[model samples]
Target chain A: MRIEHELHARRRSRNVGLGLVLLAFVALIFALTVVKVRQGDLMEAYDHQPRVSLTPLDTPAGAPAEETPAGVPAEEAP
Target chain B: MTDINAYDASPEGEFRDYVALLKPRVMSLVVFTAFVGLWVAPGQVHPFIGFCAVLFIALGGGASGALNMWYDRDIDAVMNRTRSRPIPSGRVQESEALGLGIVLGTISVMMLGLVANWFAAGFLAFTIFFYAVVYTVWLKRSTPQNIVIGGAAGAFPPMIGWACATGGIGIESILMFMLIFVWTPPHFWALALFMKEDYHRAGVPMLTVTHGRRSTRRHILAYAVALAPFAIGLGLTSIGGPLYMAVSVVLNVAFLRGCWQIFRRSEDQAIADDYAVEKRVFRLSLYYLFLHFLALLVQSWLGGW
Candidate 1:
């Protein structure tokens, strides 16, 4: 009877450990998916805004200007 | 009542404790600055990439914080400010913190590269290395100038933010970097002025412990004087305008006056006031950086600079 009881306890402990590992893996996957969805929304928003390029040195004094540098390629401009 | 499994010294891992391991205060600053950087970039970035950039930057920042905690677990146990940290408080294992830090650091850098330009991603990777290895591992215990040099680690986010938008570095981004670099010493020294005992207890070799409070006070004044010009100079840049200039003038004058008061204070007076002036200045210094960045954003929006 004693031998049988010890075997049952070992089996239960292993099963609990396996359950915790699976739980942690699932949580990590869920967090990553949420981050991905948020990124998708932001990308869509960026596409909707008007794009301009202006350097800090190029703005005239006292005037509110977008200050895009002349002659810089648009595709490469940030 | 059946004995409930309530207060095990080692309860199966709690979620809140894991979050605490990230050093949320530092992470918040990292996120804020990185956002400002993204916002202030010259052209529009796809909002998705921008979000990814900020997320990765923040994770990188958290990774450094985690690693710092892991490596400093010994000193953390000794300091009052850090005594309750996850690792030091026995809430999380040191190895767990290390593993989390390394895994997060790798993921943040790789994801940043995949989603953003390689330049921005590269900068993120370097920043993690600078904070974790150069500042935390090498400098913290070695010299009085630790904060001076380590300040570079904190200053990189704005530059990285700039890179994310433009795919290149520029004079304005460099100026933004300089502004924080100059501000760090005075802001930190003011805290060191009051917390000298903590440094002494931790044997961390802070300026207060090595050079004495008077010298630290002088250094604070010097750095504050230097910072004024840099802060105001940003006004002359394409990013600057009347709003930024006005904010810069008022804040710089107040900061100078605060530093002057700290310098002129006698030890007896400081003790009598319980270092009230130093404590207040320290609080103001926190506002000082945040306001500068906010002013920049406001100027960019209102003045369209």
Candidate 2:
């Protein structure tokens, strides 16, 4: 019986390595997913919130800065 | 006088069998790429919404796996590498895999649309169909170019991720798609080189099985050389930075060299070394994509984005 079970386990998990890979990934996703929308807040969020900002990332190497969201309006640009 | 779950004659399998049908390893890759897609996109996703989006994408990937396993069971039973898979082993039934595939695939698409955007959900739906039907049913048995074209299915995750964030596509997302699409051929061909026997026995017309090893080797080299520009171009995109460029340069050089070694090897030399060089290249291919994406993620974490 034990022999049969071992053979079954061997064939079953074929690449236990892959299973490990999956578990590690799930754990990582779980860790990263800090907030959960209980009542399906998807539409409201997608309708209102833009997950990534649309602002341009760069202004040619020597361009002057404007609308510094990262800094106080009165303070000097870092 | 029969039980339904006993669709296969074996010990009725276990809880793990259901998970096995999902091909968790492939799901991991999809989850990683999709999360990176959402993370690196120009805007910010609410934490909860982002979670739901990635979850649905992951489930969708799993559903594709179940379907693949269900359909491929016949050939899978013939291939040593896949014979032990649940459906083929009869530990879990084909009917069970099909059911799981439909249920999970539907739920995932609907939820992704609800949580992300319709465009992203639609993209996810297309990806599932492309993988389950177009690639598996239509492509796998029919041609040597199966992976070359079918690679599109694997390449869509990051694009879907990008859509989840911005609700549309851009050159950066397209380039991301191109990087994976181009990367798939060389990656799988190298594995096929080593495992051609399994493909031959299974009657799957993998490039290595249909084309001789020498030809497959040349193709690997061609793709490795071709993959360079897209990978580097991606590094120059909004998502790229000095760090990405450095990593890309180093990795690309090593990648080209690996392919060169494989290309130059005679069958005699390969057999002598037990295809050691081919095996090494195959393993490196896994790291190649991961580091590229990881560098992008790290760059973003460091505010390069």
Candidate 3:
């Protein structure tokens, strides 16, 4: 009876350890999925090229925009 | 003192015991400093990524705590403060804690890499290894200088936070790291001074046990002297402002005075008062770290405004 009880205790402890391991593994997979979904197209593009340029911003009229030579709006003239 | 009852007969270790194994108090400090790091950095990260970074950092810290508890189970069983810990109390088996620690540690690092930047993930991995392998398994049993060198492990969260935001390390990150590193010795040794008997019983070789209390006191004073300059020096960096400088000055002055008082007292007085001075110093040390990081957060907010 003593030996049988000891074996059962050992088995129970092993199962508990296994459960904790499984929980941690599940959490890791969930985290990885979240990162993947969030990255979207950015990950794909970054993999292909190392550098990307930013698109220029459009300035509204009479909004203290960057001054062109002759004090004329470059976008307006051309 | 020798026969004090530290562990009580609780129910067989359950999920809660496992959570307790992670040392949540320590994890909180890790989270706060890492947040400060993320907040003060000079760029913006998506809110989601920032949150993920902090989460993974906290997990990594917890993982380290779990591993420490696992490895130190033998000594922990003997120490009064640690006797009630999961492993010592037979609530959770040692191997279970070890496995939990390893799995969580790996997951946290990998998630940090995928969610934030590789730099942050790599730093987290190194911090875990440093604490688990270098400190827990090696330095802890070997020398009294364990906490001094091991302090690096706790100091990495802020740098990890900085990396999450900037995707690289900078002077500001190093300063944050140095602040914690310098603060650790004095903070921990204060507790060690009070808990010398516990450490002696456990054969842990703390500074007070290996060297005399007088030496430990002197060491605390020395570290406090060094810490003040580093604390105040943060004010001159890009992250610093008048508010942080003022707070740092006052805290450092108060801390230095405390250390001086600790140094002036003899072992007899410490024993007579049940090491009240040492205990007060330990509590103050906790407040010191929180206030320092809080001051940094305030400075960052004020700077933005």
For every candidate, how close is chain A to the native chain A in TM-score?
A: 0.43, 0.30, 0.44
Docking class of predicted structure 2: incorrect
TM-score of 3: 0.79
Proportion of the native interface contacts kept in model 1: 0.00
Would you list the clashing residue pairs of candidate 3? B13-B91
lDDT of 2 at B211: 77
Ranking by lDDT: 3, 2, 1
Model 1 lDDT tens row, B19-130: 6777888888888888887787789776756777887899899898889899999999998888988888887788889998998899888877766678998999899899
Stretches of candidate 2 off by over 4 Å are A1-78, B1-11
**Per-model fnat list:** 0.00, 0.08, 0.00
Write down the lDDT of every candidate, Cα atoms only: 0.82, 0.84, 0.85
Which of the two candidates, 1 or 3, achieves a greater TM-score against the reference? 3
Off by more than 4 A, model 3: A1-41, A45-78, B1-12
Candidate 1 docks at the CAPRI level of: incorrect
DockQ of each: 0.04, 0.07, 0.05
Please tell me which predicted candidate would have the highest TM-score against the true structure: 3
